[model samples]
Target: MTSPGMSITQLLPDGKLIVLCGRADDASAWQDLLGPARCLAIALDDAPHEARPRTLRGASDHLAWQHHAIGGLDGSGWLAEPADAFDPDHTATLVLPDPLDPPDAGNRRRFGFRRPAWRLFEDKTMVDTLWDAAGVPRAPSIVGDGTADLSVLGAIVDQGTGVVCSCQPRGAGPSAGGDGIWWWREGPPPTTIPTAGPGTWRVRLMPLLEGVPVRLHGLALTTRIIPFPPMELVTLPRPGQGTFLCAGAVPLLDDAADLVTHTERIGVGLRERLGYRGGFSVDGILTPSGFQPTDFNARLTSAMEAAPSDRRVLLHAVNLLAREGNEPDTGAVEQLAEDLFTIGTSCTIFGAATHADDRASRTTSVRWDGDRLVPAPSGAADGRLLITPSPRGWLLTATLATARLPGGGRVGPRAPEIFRVSDEVLGTNFGHLVPPFDTRPSACLPKVALNPEPATR
Candidate 1:
């Protein structure tokens, strides 16, 4: 068991740490969060080739890079050059897996990675069952094989808008962020689904809940669960195109006490049922009928990744300790959650596909002018917009000056304008994207008790 006073460095294994990620910024960010320590950070992306410790570019397969890293410093292949730095007998290497990938089995040197069994919950088709067991209210959904008639299943759950079909990663690897999902209205069904691999895959059909998409993050400790504030998932749908873009996340304005309660219940259910420990998030749409969950992420989600560096680092340490069967100080964990709530600031980063291969990085001072983002002097700016390249495309990180935001309202509506500004000034290509609709809280739904008993399905 770790003491409450132990720092994040103390909780980690005593050895040379290796941080592996898909983005250069991610590698640098993780290195910063881990504090001043003896760490070797490696990024597997094409951009920012000059970063410290260097990056292994042209490696399209992030999982394969992780697998190579797990093989230790003595092995050959892509890691051989990087492996020449340290002697295997004298220097013990501890690896930090990519946030999206779980650590391989029998690797005792890996830290802060999700268990392989818990990774199963990330499949879109399997989350509804967990929601039911947790007593979290969700829209109707049905899972079927790839060849199953989606129209029939879509009719069963289709509201007025349409049904959402999310592909199941059965034999293939897990779906990338926001991939493998499509919105269908009336058509012959999707001919191609975005999955990690080819061949047949399962699908989960559910009603496309209309409202503001929000995600509630929670940390499950040994004794209890700590829920964080809700963030608006800035999802832009390309209507008739059957696809949606996950632009970024910002703090939600609506009161979400009931949603927080549901998050707590879900934490209990996950702990009791699956012995799940660490951070998890529930993605849902706040509709006219209340918050209806749509997806569950068992690993460290992007929202959590966007939190303040101090909070993120602490939570990561606590999560790693809890997952290793060690009890973290409950009171300290509660205090950390309360501190995050009191801060009430969110990290907003907009994503878009780009054709540029510059592999360069740029930061611009900007402020929100009405509904658009315009350049401003650094001292007078409301936020700083950073553009960086990733394996998929480019990422625009908007570090907002919270006090300067007018009304402190939701940032979802401004995503399209951000892309427009980027394309115009930065010479990047991000085509038209539709903004999300405002949320409508349900009047018929009753308030959820903060401390309700666990309910069975």
Candidate 2:
């Protein structure tokens, strides 16, 4: 019998075609999308025990990034472990950003000119100009020339409307989500400067709107878009951390469809107009009147990483539809996608102790001395060396713990103790199936948040 299909071909400039797989998508999408020029499919989901990682690395005739979602593509701690031998590509896989441009035959860069529109997102000030020019209504802001006058914030605040404050190259003294401190208050900007005084700082201030905040994560690939469901954000106050305990996305938004449409249009604009590619998210408030965009992160935001199990079909389908090929068998694909979405969920919830910057300081754990759980000294970093590409390190650690468990009679981790979520942190739910994922209530939320740390998407 033929195995369930997965790997597909990518034509290299060297006139050779390389086989690529290991992402979540099954091979059928490529087969349905690419038709038949050359097909050497290896459906990982159906591979035998002990043969999985070996199966993946065997196809590494050409080097590629490790995709942990499919498993085995990353190395194992097991003896005689059949996992990927990726010494060359491991560094790029850890701190993921697109790889730097490689020089060509005459040592000239060929695709450097075709860079993604990361500037429009990372450079928050630039995002303002680009979104404004595109006529997308975002929060109003007061941009300032790097001056040390926190006094000027008085004018915007004294008007009785609360204002949000931030500075360039963000991520110091009171920032969350992205770098740069932000706060909601009814008066003039806080008198105190969180970091260094101006001249080196470019600032932005906007009136705080009392609306329901939501975040949408999606892909912005060249010539296409892959939008995920809208997530409602509950901003919990954390007086000590400056940033709140952030989480959400259930009780279903009253008008989720409209939010999706608006978001996808914005995503499309980013792709077609400014030449964007890769993961991104848009943060906004869902006012009683309508949704308004607040922040646009060019790179992947935490919410995208927390994607619901069911959205996988939507994600893979978009990639297939974007390529040139025989028209996809949409009905067949959707039915399969639907089944996968409902039953194939590998996780239920995610968590995180979000801060705008400095992850190394936050994830330290001296908590467990065998049977005793004790807090480690601040900055105590001791544990097996586990690295995740995401900014949400805590969530990555939990997921790896759960996923590596012995499955179908395989050897799992030696020490089988993954951390559990704390009661204090609020969590959002995933999956449309009933009766709870593992008998845990939706509020028993599978992820976590601890002070400035917890589960994340």
Identify the leading candidate in terms of TM-score.
1
Give the lowest summed-lDDT range of ten residues in model 1: 51-60
RMSD score of candidate 2 (Å): 14.6
lDDT of 1: 0.64
lDDT, residue 263, candidate 1: 78
lDDT of 1 by residue, 348-370 (tens): 66664554436433666788787
Error of 2 at 174 (Å): 15
Clashing pairs in 1: none
Error of 1 at 221 (Å): 1.3
Q: State every prediction's TM-score relative to the real structure.
A: 0.80, 0.49
Instruction: Residues 354-435, candidate 2: write the lDDT tens digits.
Output: 2223324323343345432233456532232122322232232323222222331111111122222121111211111111
Angstrom error at residue 331, model 1? 3.6
